[model samples]
Target: MSVQLVANVLIGIALVVFLGYRQATWRYLDPTRIWRTPLIMAIVGVVVLAQTTTTITTTDVVFLGIEALITVGVGLTMGSITRFRTVATPDSKGRTIQSRTGLLGAALWIVLIAVRVGLDVVGGHLGAHLLTSTGTILLVLALNRAARAVVIDQRIPRDDREARGMMVR
Candidate 1:
């Protein structure tokens, strides 16, 4: 292993740790319908990336597909475990309070990153580029976000107008 790669990775890990913890500090963020498309796009884009990559093999894609499913399952479980509080009162901005009881999101973020890093490291040793590829990382993140969004959406209540429509504000 190159010393430079080790140093760079160490720095990256440190940054991720900091950011993961920081995410927990958020009291709450409004769940607007605006985020739906982007989150869905994130999930689709990774699959497209996988199909377009000529260097990756069929076996790699299958493995990644399995990993994606597993990640989604775990993410869903964790997201459900995460506590959300919808305050009865809307803010001055007229936004509902979508809050978490603990650092579950932060915890999920760390696990996602750690899993990606672990796979990358092992794949490097085995010459499995797919396992360590950018598409894999994006897929993990996309699935994680999707699961959380699904759970949070179920937790927050929307008005009749919003519910009647496809969007939730």
Candidate 2:
């Protein structure tokens, strides 16, 4: 394997471990916390893509498009399945929404990873080199996380008293 490929694999493993743990735990659904990760990943992905020299091909584009769609779809499904509850906290004006992925959401993450790997294998044979690149992987992951965050954010209770209290109890 090339150095880049090895590095990508190591990074992928690290992400799987870290995100897997984080997803299983309950976390405050603050906008900054929810959005920061994907945004940073996207910027880094763009930078990496810019620095790397690779020939662009229609096959690569098509594969990436399919991967992105699946990523977003899985993310949406995960978000919908996530457990959200409002809890009384010292911060956030008395209560705030907290989210936990639990087992089902984690399963979806595995499914997403499996689907990506399967695509990578198929795309590799078809000359879609970009699909498995470090930069492309990061971009796809960011897209997935962003989509999940969108659904979670939408599910959060509004500022209104009734809505905010809906999840409490």
Over 104-150, each residue of candidate 1 has an lDDT whose tens digit, in order, gives: 65776667667767766666566666665444555565676566666
- Candidate 2 colliding pairs: none
Would you give me the overall lDDT of model 1?
0.58
Which candidate wins on TM-score?
A: 2
lDDT of each: 0.58, 0.81
Rate residue 77 of model 2 by lDDT.
84
Best by lDDT: 2
RMSD of 2: 4.2
Candidate 2 off by > 4 Å: 89-95, 159-169
Over 4 Å off in model 1, which ranges? 1-23, 33-54, 86-89, 157-169
Q: Across residues 1-169, which tens digit of lDDT does each residue of candidate 2 receive? A: 8999899889988998788887899876665556778989999999998887888899999999999999999888877888877776635544466778887777787888888889999999999888778989899999988888777767776652433211223
